[model samples]
Target: MDDEPEVVEAELVEDDRLPAIAEDRSPAVLLAEEDPDAWLPPEAEEDVQAGIPKDTSRAYKGDMDRFAEWCETVGRRVMPAAPQTVTAYMSYLKRTPREKTGRPYGPNSMDRIIASIRSSHRAAGFEPPDTMGARKVVAGYREQLALAKDPAAQPRKATPADRRVLHQALARLDRTTLVGKRDAALMLLGHALASRGSELAPLDWPGSFTELPEGGFRVRVYRKKRKKWQNVEVLPDPELEMCTVTAVRDLVEALAREGHTSGPLFMRIDQWGYMGVEMTRNGEPIGDPTGRISVNGASDVVSRSIARTGLPGDWRSHSLRRGFVKSARDAGVDIVDIGRHGGWDDQSKALIGYVDEEDSSGERNPLAQIGKAAMKKRGDGGE
Candidate 1:
């Protein structure tokens, strides 16, 4: 069934900043911080706004708001902040424990905080402070933290949802049920597209996925980090158990039957296996016209779906994307091709790190090749 067209337009934030700015706070400052168009000249605003994702802009604004509060508290300037003020602020953040973890902020968190400060300064048309000293403090703290073996400083990676795990998880899904159909589609398409939860959450039906004559689908994803739309090609999966195209097609048809022809491709399914709804003031029920699964909600779907199969691993939505990297590498796809498919920047450190980790041992290792040669020599009695 061709679920034909309707188009729609659409952060690693793990830290608690200072308390929210009071409602009585300066409206002008808030407006300027929240909307660049409020302060920036019209000619410069569009380009600057287009460069950053909405989520990022929101995050940077929040960071600046908190910084403004900190400035108020300390009687320091928020915009055109002196290097000393930023340094002091970084020092303050270092000592402050996060509300959830009750632990000091992570190194990456510190870097992001500094970036937000720099961004706020730039947004206000002020030259960014030379944060060399503040950065050094973070660098020193990171080293000391590493030496102490703090888990906070360590990079965490999701366990890749390899073919075995994916097959097992897919087999357990009851495609007959709406919830099951959604889960199956979410996992398969997520892996095929190598998409982030943020990227997948905003996908709209019929518009996002285009049917190719040759087979599979061409998915248009607005990659958040890159701040651009990229077309991703998902090849046809012959394996019935893990066929991404088939799963998506089935889910779309099922949702179409439920009178949900548009809006988010993946949406919340209620407990009774019904699509979600939002009631209006007069008690009229309107189906979730614009609601899409949240990033966390999407991750939970992946985790719960895997859990149903009794797989022993910590899986998250990112596992599907990471798995695509590993799977493609195993299939002898080039690193460059994998990055392009996965929305990773060419020569991305994170992407290269995955490849390096994959090749760290076994036949991919140079030492392993030497060892194999030695084994052959020993078997031939040639020393």
Candidate 2:
């Protein structure tokens, strides 16, 4: 992962061409001079040109293109989008409902779009003033929205009851058939692992998992967030018990039984055990090889399961993680212990934050008899 010294030197030299700013101050102008080809390392360059799966170059390019179009429409250059302009764009998105979907963009989507723009600017070796200050502005906007007294301003959280309904709905899905089995397995594994959509979407059989003894398997995960080496681990849960490891193994085995060993784990199944895509050209399925399941796909699975069983409250993929944490806490597991299992490094702090206020209150409750006896002890009626 080390960048060659020469490459670093060259990049620094190129960066020097940009306007000089005060050493203490962040740059305001983004310079788009460095060639995209030169940005990647030697190994990554190969992966990029070869069109390997999970390469985000296309997505980045798309973001850049969209930003370019936006800049043109606003009569501004990509280097310096004013803070007000950024705010206006966010406001526009909030008011303008999506054309086909009819849903206006939310804070999360707006944040991502701004993030994409910021990332693009940074990649191009330019610093934008608004980019540095956008997060604070967004925070302020959220605060204002929260205090506006609008019903939609306050977002609701998925409750434990809602999760129970979702689980019950998923349980009703018949797993005897291939599609049912696949869906069930996918749902179970996704929930058990608490994996992101992207992590599960690009899974390839035979490549990602190796069978282990004692009804377990070793699974290799490529964590995009880390941008480092792969994580390989043995899942030790019993297959019959529906533990996290078991759930994922069951899904992998289901796909394996159908003779699929070298493609995306979750795919649109067709006859003869062949997987198909929703859209294709020249009969070749266009799998989203970016290792990302569409947000719609994740939402649809959870929502359909909930709808079938008439579940209460909104159920989303994140419910799984929340449920796991809450369930663990209720089961008498220490927060630190639960945090470790959930891959959280700051388990103590997280535990403090996650604990229910009521739970802590019970711990602080004093025994009435003991307190009264202690208070009446020494210099009481006898003295």
Give per-model CA RMSD. 7.2, 9.0
Over 226-336, each residue of candidate 1 has an lDDT whose tens digit, in order, gives 768999988778788788888898998999998999878898876787676453557775544565777777888888988888877668888888788888887879999
lDDT agreement with native, every candidate: 0.75, 0.52
Cα-based lDDT at residue 78, candidate 1: 67
- Count of clashes in candidate 2: 3
Task: Judging by TM-score against the true structure, name the best candidate.
Answer: 1
Candidate whose lDDT is highest: 1
Q: Model 2 TM-score?
A: 0.62
Superposed Cα deviation of residue 192, candidate 1 (Å): 0.7
Question: Which residue runs of candidate 2 sit more than 4 Å off their true CA positions?
Answer: 1-67, 82-84, 87-104, 131-137, 149-167, 202-214, 228-257, 261-267, 270-284, 288-299, 313-316, 347-383
lDDT against true structure, model 2: 0.52
Q: After superposition, how far is residue 208 of candidate 2 from its true place, in Å?
A: 3.9
Query: TM per model?
Result: 0.79, 0.62
Q: After superposition, how far is residue 135 of candidate 1 from its true place, in Å?
A: 1.0
Among residues 3 or more apart in sequence or in different chains, the pairs in candidate 2 whose N, CA or C atoms overlap within 3 Å are: 30-126, 30-127, 31-126
